[model samples]
Target: MAESPPLPPLAVDIDGTLTDDRRRLDHRVPSLLRKWADAAPVVVATGKALPYPVALCEFLGIPTTVVAENGGAAYVERTDELRFVGDRRAAEAVAEEYAAAGHSLGWGEVDLPNRWRETELAVSREQPLEPLEGIAARHGLEVVDTGFAYHVKSPDVDKAKGLTAVADALGIEVESFAAIGDSANDVGMLERARISYAVANADEAAREAADHVTDGTYGDGFIEAAERIRAGVD
Candidate 1:
């Protein structure tokens, strides 16, 4: 008899899903990922900047591409190649306007990896997103709140689009991957994956979009999803 087909790749969001907090990754994540990487490829799809995801891929020793800037850029770790597709001019213009108008917008509680980004402008999540939303709408831009940071980008850029780019580069179908996420920016990829999971800590929108909600939070939830994927338990 023929052997069963191989499992598809695993795509994960960086913040809130893979890490316990902004500064910490789950201790169990590396080992579990080592096992999973042997079975299938792993991709980091996030709203983070290029360096952060690229560094993560390096640390994991996973030869995978990273989707950064909330889909604004895709970086191939092995080749050290970076591609930028997100249009941030309009967003930048709007941000400047808001700043000039006396909004206290700046990088949030954590250090911003994309503070010097060219494809997107991110501000602290502490600010009201409503005004930015209205401003973005008028300028044909999209404002995405990732819980930790608010990303202003083109409407065409999103996590799903980033996943599609990675899948294309790997010669795989988007439906062949499983996705894990925990925020509004993750919604598109979550809905696009063959199977999607949201951590227990996810917000309502993400939880609602996911195929399953893991009982654990943060890294634990991610491990739970990975195990279930290995088990083929759906």
Candidate 2:
């Protein structure tokens, strides 16, 4: 019999998966990431700005891709190819509407990453999501809560779209990959990949969408996922 194909690359979330809610990477994560990189491609899919994810990839000394701005942009490290995927104007409009609602918005309190994002507007999660969804709907936009913040983005653009693009760029089948994340933004990608994991700390919806929920939380769960993938458990 022919040998089964090797597992495809891993597409991982940044905040709340590889790092804690406080935004610190556990010491174990980098080594596990390095090992994974040695075995196959590791793409960092995140709601963070391009530079931030790129910086992490750099720090790891791993040649990997990044899907940033909640699927709005992706960078292929080895090729230095950058692709922008979402509606920037729509995102800005959503931000404006949210600001008009008199809620503290952008670069205040908890959303420092707001200034760095160009295609997704970061809104305070403290603001009720129901009203924010209504505001987003007015412009045909979408709102996703990423634990730390709420993101205003194009309804059609999301992590799944970004992951597909990265898979295409790498000439790999999307179904061959594994996706791990812990928030509403990650649900789409989780559902799309053949092998999907929701870390123990994942948002309820994300946990529901995933094929497996890791036994550990945050970095620990991510490490567990890596082990499961290597073990070929469905």
Candidate 3:
């Protein structure tokens, strides 16, 4: 189904799409994903770090175009093009404020989520959002709850920008991509794609942004959307 007649490329989110309810990888998807990779160019867009998306694609033997750290960075593997669009220091400042208050990120104690994160910061959902939001506002940053964690980054660095950057690098249009996801952080990317879908379990913002909602949940929903795309269903 590799775009024989030039259908749009595909942009996918990993955590809620490729993972099950527990956020663990679904064994069924890797094999099915190769067929997806064959359908069109794939962009692994996620709020995760740069290494996460790139490594996942490499392991799966898929082409790598990543919008990582919620669009804080965009990297295209074939061209060796990499662009970062956010200020890391804002997140660092938020960390400092948290430290002063005797708190650490990602449930404290050597915050693993932010370890490889090059830009912005991710706080554990256990942290209170009010104070964090206040701190973020003061620093001109915004906090997004991606269900897995609380992401603190710039409003200007949404996934849409990252998708656009990746599309341009591939000589494609952002509007020519079909996107899928299940969280608020994915809203911008969903809105930018020509056709977008929300997994049945998607959060409110994501569902609202998507043009369609699949009957399946999580990975199944993703696969369903991919099949529809391959079948050329509008």
Candidate 4:
């Protein structure tokens, strides 16, 4: 039998990696995360804003840093320390630019009544576009095509940046990391890690980019990926 490689720190995506298509968090995934946390740091990196990951970490009983709003913001929950990586002034400038171009930008953190633990930004289509590429080209933001909606985001803010930030804070190198996800947004983090896994339900782009493709979906898929990482296979 081949010897297993050393286990690495885990960075996981939220929506599709740990939850189902409906966005409900599964209990088993958190349990498995905690199990792994005993040996390595497990960071939750998600496109969702701060509150979601904060709720998740609290529910999971895992004391880990969270990278929220893609890579725009990060937070260490234990200390309540927050880092706004993306320039707020820059974000505001971009927002103005988009608005001037007649594109609707849905600001994620703006309307929330309570102060957020992390920074988050979401750009969505308020009106239909005849050609989607036009908007993307105009703003230089990546256009993500969801089944029902279109999302535009800064090219700089991505899952990979978030993962790297968390790893750096924890003093873990990129080579000693594993990433798992199921979307185009997850592609960066997937590529950044030494080992990357895409779930059965992952998008084609994500699957193609991943080092390994898991047979399971959602939480079950993540569990399977964790098992494979523990067992050590490229």
Between prediction 2 and prediction 3, which has the larger lDDT?
3
Which clashing pairs does model 3 show? Answer: none
Comparison by TM-score, 3 against 4, better one:
3
- lDDT of each candidate versus the true structure: 0.82, 0.85, 0.87, 0.72
lDDT of 3 at 143: 95
- Sorted by TM-score, highest first, which candidate order results? 3, 2, 1, 4
Each candidate structure's TM-score, on Cα atoms with residue i matched to residue i, is 0.91, 0.91, 0.94, 0.80
Predicted candidate 1 versus true structure: per-residue lDDT over 61-121, tens digit per residue: 7775888888888876555667788667787788877777677566544545556576887
Q: What is the lDDT of candidate 4?
A: 0.72
Predicted structure 4, TM vs. truth: 0.80
Q: Give the TM-score (vs. native) of candidate 1.
A: 0.91
Q: Find the candidate with the highest lDDT and give its number.
A: 3
Per-residue lDDT tens digits of candidate 2, residues 45-161?
999888988999899988859999889989897767888877778777777776688755646666567766878777766666876788888888888788888888887888899
Candidate 3 wrongly placed segments (more than 4 Å):
1-7
| All models, RMSD in angstroms | 2.6, 2.6, 2.1, 3.9
Misplaced by over 4 Å in model 2 are: 1-7, 109-111
lDDT of the structure predicted as candidate 3: 0.87
Winner by TM-score: 3
Between candidates 2 and 3, the TM-score winner: 3
In candidate 4, list every pair of residues with a backbone clash: none
Q: Is candidate 2 or candidate 4 better by TM-score?
A: 2
